[model samples]
Target: MYVRHVAAAAAAFLGWALVLSGGPATTATAAASGESTTAAAATGRDPVRLVGAPVLYAHRGASAYAPENTLAAVDLAEDLGIDWVENDVQRTKDGELVVIHDDTLARTTDVETRYPDRKPWRVADFTAAEIAGLDAGSWFTPQFAGARVPTLRQYLDRVRFNQQKLLLEIKKPELYPGIEQDTLRVLEEAGWLGEQQVENRLVVQSFSVDCVRTVHSLRPDLITAFLGTPAAEDLALYAEFTDRINPWHTTITAEWVAAVHALRGVHGEPLEVDTWIVDDPAVARKVQAMGVDGIITNAPDVVREAVGGF
Candidate 1:
């Protein structure tokens, strides 16, 4: 069934591509552009060679050094020589997309004190401007005072300007309706989508299978990763739609990795397997030996060193 759907989608894409190609010269140019984009997207920027070990992705932009989901955290990851940074995305009440991990602002901002009457004061209930008004950084450190929650465009621009790869987690799709559409819109508006070649540099991840499916439907070229706890049945389901499977590192084993690799997607491609929050050097080495494609961690510097030793 998955293979059939992929064939159908590919046929549709080919039809669209042909319709856009009116002349031979135009057709040739489009084909060339498509090839270039595919190559660029396939090559991720991480420095750790994946031949012997998994790539190191900075979880929440090196959350140990800076507030998670902040631009500062992402910048810190880049400066630390990490190749790829991971962050989360949530929608606002006004349909603006912002970078944040939690559904509510209580933990990261001073919202509870300022707006006492706002019940269920979730991030989805506030507009972008309302979210920006709250101090999002001081909770982590006094030095990071006045840090504001950034929009998806701002975060993408920063990542692109720095020439970095990203693992963008789409959070809480159920609470925020039309999140997939909003996310695609932000990527398109930032010139990250469309016929451009940078699609491979970005990986759209979600715990929700439906949301991941929605993204895959709209942009088949963009890599989609399904995040879930390690379970044979869950992994089997994810094998249908995702290019990669990210399971909690604690639950991952060699058998799990083998199972994920054996399961093919709708494209008949083997799904890449990765695990997260692997901060210990010994554990990192162990997981790398398990044959996972990447390891997401809060401590990229430590993982980089461990990978270098191998």
Candidate 2:
């Protein structure tokens, strides 16, 4: 029954794309005016019209087509018309931010086989160079042989050069002592932190309120998203720290969406709600029908088609 629902949703999204062609003309005009103006205008109930084209966020840089969290994956997402490239950030032994989804490096890389004696905590003991030496891509596919782990700087540089927006997830802040500082420093060094204009393009997200709060305090203009599956009572605490809430799709009810929109940020504006890892078209449509601001997924092309027709 579940599989059948997923297929029907996927099919519906595919069929919907055939009906819609491009983004709303109003949104294009708004994007041209600048991020602040556009974001401000979008705050209204109508905001920037989704016009059925859901915001396409490339989950782990389009993991479906390329090695997750790699520069190659981000590039492929850009090529495929993805609006935002999402990636995870973790600190290396030397206090540098690197992009990788897992802390152990077991599932995505050959680290486990190469260093069986070295436990998962061993990652924190190794320098970035040593960590980078592990083949991160081969495990994903034989075709992507020799793909190495990329530093956050390399990842950000590539994305900036490509003019792509980024959704950066700070992973396990407590485990990495100075990960937040290092991450902030890297973005600053890359000239991604200083100015107001650049800040709008970045969305920093984390499950930890402290992590997101730290970033918000340092770079107040930088958009911060609280990533969690919390009860209604817990949401008020989250709202105090972040501009947006990125809840697990399953946890998001229609009432939750309505409630989230009712709560105002520090600026006295409605909070933006984004749900993650939604790949099925019917669920996507249901979420859209519920009026979610964004949906993150591995199959961005599928979501794009679903939202376009919606």
lDDT of each: 0.72, 0.71
Q: Which ten-residue region of model 1 has the weakest summed lDDT?
A: 19-28
Q: Which candidate should be chosen as best, given lDDT against the real structure?
A: 1
Candidate 1 per-residue lDDT over residues 190-225, each given as its tens digit: 878755434457788999989999999988877788
Model 2, range 69-175, lDDT digits (tens) per residue? 98868876765556588999987778767899888778888887777877763556668888888888787767667888899999989888888888899998888
RMSD of 1: 13.9
Give the Cα-based TM-score of candidate 1 against the true structure.
0.80
Model 1, position 283, has a per-residue lDDT of 78
For model 1, the local distance difference test gives 0.72
Clashing pairs in 1: none
lDDT of 2 at 308: 54
TM-scores, in order shown? 0.80, 0.81
